[model samples]
Target: MARNTERRSALADAGIRVLAEQGARGLTHRAVDVAAGTPRGTASNYFPSRDDLISALVGRIGERLTPDPTRLSSHAARTPDRDLFADYLRDVVRRLSTDPHVPLALFELRLEAARRPAVAKALGAWRQRAFEDDVAFNDESDLPGGRTEIALFHYAIDGLMLDNLTAPIDSGLSVDAAIDELVDRILR
Candidate 1:
């Protein structure tokens, strides 16, 4: 069972790389097999159809993007202040900037989701998980506005991340500064 889990994880990672490099049109069982460096037919054995593979890939991306509970707990325990929240936002921006492929693949999946119902369903669930996590984090930190604040925060961060990833220009303000400004506006 563990071996199967590992293999599935490897295939999912390969699928992400393929999606990043080749886009949705290029994501296929055979392509994933080649990217994974495994024998041919491995991806097919795990994910029987394109929708299945896409679904798995969506889950995999969520896993990569979401902060672990332990990390969240440690951060909250250390200092549940606005500064810590700003630091968390900075880390999020840093990950998006440094690991461009992950977001690139995610964007591809999002575009694909428009045309594929299964992919759309997976994305919806993934988004819900993120929303829930944000709510929990806000509650734990004793932040105001509850879900409304989280909704705005997510929208702002999404825009910032998309802009930063697409056309990163030195606008005199660092990413950290931008995050601080946004967080302040949202939390205030």
Candidate 2:
């Protein structure tokens, strides 16, 4: 069972790399096998279809991107709410800027999900889980406005991420400044 789990994880990681580098068209079972350094037919054994593979990839990407609670708590211990929020946003943008492949692969998955119902269903579930996690995090932090604030925060961050990922231009505002502005608006 452990070996199976490991192999699935490896394949999912490989799929992320492939999706990032080659787009959705290049995400084939055989391609994942090659990227994973596994023998032929390995990816197929785990994910029987393209939808299955994509579903797994979405879950894997979410796992990789979710912030670690211990790290968050440590940072939160010393900072106030607004500063903590800004710092969290800064950290997310920094990660996206540094390792663009994760977000790039996510964009690909999102686009592919549009034309594929199975992928769309999977993505919807993933999104719901993400939303629940965000709500829980905000509640734990004792942030005001509950789910509405969390949703707005997500929208603001999503816009920032989309702009940075798609049309990366010098907006004349530093990332930290933009995050501070956003934090002020949301927390006000």
Candidate 3:
């Protein structure tokens, strides 16, 4: 059983590497087996279908993006620090830049989820949970735009991620400057 699990993990990691380097269409059990250094038939032993393999791969990637609810709750206990937001933006950008494969995996999973209802539902649940927490944290009571404004603010961030993933993002903008621009736009 342990050996089987190890083989499964190896296959999943291999799949990520393949998808990252060649995109989703290039993924195959033979490719993953070669990448993982496992026997050609090893992938089939664990992942009987391509969808099954992809589901595992997507779940693993999604887990990375799913924020810990408890962590946000703990942060909420402290007073808002403007500097922290800048730090977070910097961290996010750094991660995006350094881990180019992460966004690629995310894009593949997101696109696949669009075609599969079950996958889409799961992704939607994960996204909703994350968005709910953000909405709770940034609640602006009686503000004209209120939650809609917050949602749009988040939408812009998502758009930024997609744009950066699609093209080389300029390195000139400091994280603080970017956050300040976002805050300025949203606050007004």
Candidate 4:
């Protein structure tokens, strides 16, 4: 049977919520069905297997975390400089933190990947493509950084998001200040 795109998206989103709240072990098909408010086996009917469900989650997270194209293009039109880079990074973080469940579920999947190769395989490929897309965007926009610099920013941004979502080491520390510092030190 042909799967409904909307239903699949909803199920995957529900899976994200389940993963965020209950971790990988709790992300069963029934759990996703419950989260989506669908009948029993709805998620399984759509996904067919756990791996398929995970692949859908990875795809949906990419959609959720993607930068808004309007904002992205406006930033791209800016004169490339450290300030612009910092602003771009700020937007990236804002998108990441907009939905608490998206990042929380992402971290949960990353941790689960250590034991489940299926998760690793799906997430790894998705992350690599995302990295390449970032590099391409930076290059096309004349952003003040090379691929290595972009990689460093990615690492820093992930750490910053993790801190914000989980528990901050210093609650009073300024994320903006940290982003500025990263741009100042990494870009120029």
Candidate 1 on 1-188: residue-level lDDT in tens?
12498899999999999998999999999999999999998999999889889889988887787675676676767656678877777766665666677888888888998998888898888888889987986787875547887788788777777777678666787777887887788878
CA shift of 118, model 3, Å: 5.0
Each prediction's number of clashing residue pairs = 0, 0, 0, 0
Model 2 steric clash total: 0
Residues 46-145 of candidate 2 have per-residue lDDT tens digits of: 9998988998899888878877778787876864467776777777676666667788888888898898888888988898888998788778876544
Model 3 ranges off by over 4 Å: 1-7, 66-78, 114-119, 133-150, 169-172
TM-score of each: 0.89, 0.89, 0.69, 0.96
Candidate 3, clashing residue pairs? none
**What C-alpha lDDT does candidate 1 achieve relative to the native structure?**
0.82
Candidate 2 Cα misplacement greater than 4 A, ranges: 1-3, 95-98
- Residue 90 displacement (Å), model 1: 2.1
Candidate 4: segments with Cα more than 4 A from true spot: none
Tens digits of per-residue lDDT, candidate 4, 1-188, equal: 33699998999999999999999999999999999999998998998899999999999999998888899778767788888989989999988888899999999999989999989999999999999999998888887889999999999999999988877898565989999988988877
| Per-residue lDDT of model 3, residues 1-188, tens digit only | 12566566667878887888877688888888888898887877777787677776766565545445675465556555544444434544555555667667767767867788875776677667767765765553222234676577567666677777787478676545766677666666
Error of 3 at 163 (Å): 2.8
RMSD of every prediction: 2.2, 2.1, 4.4, 1.2
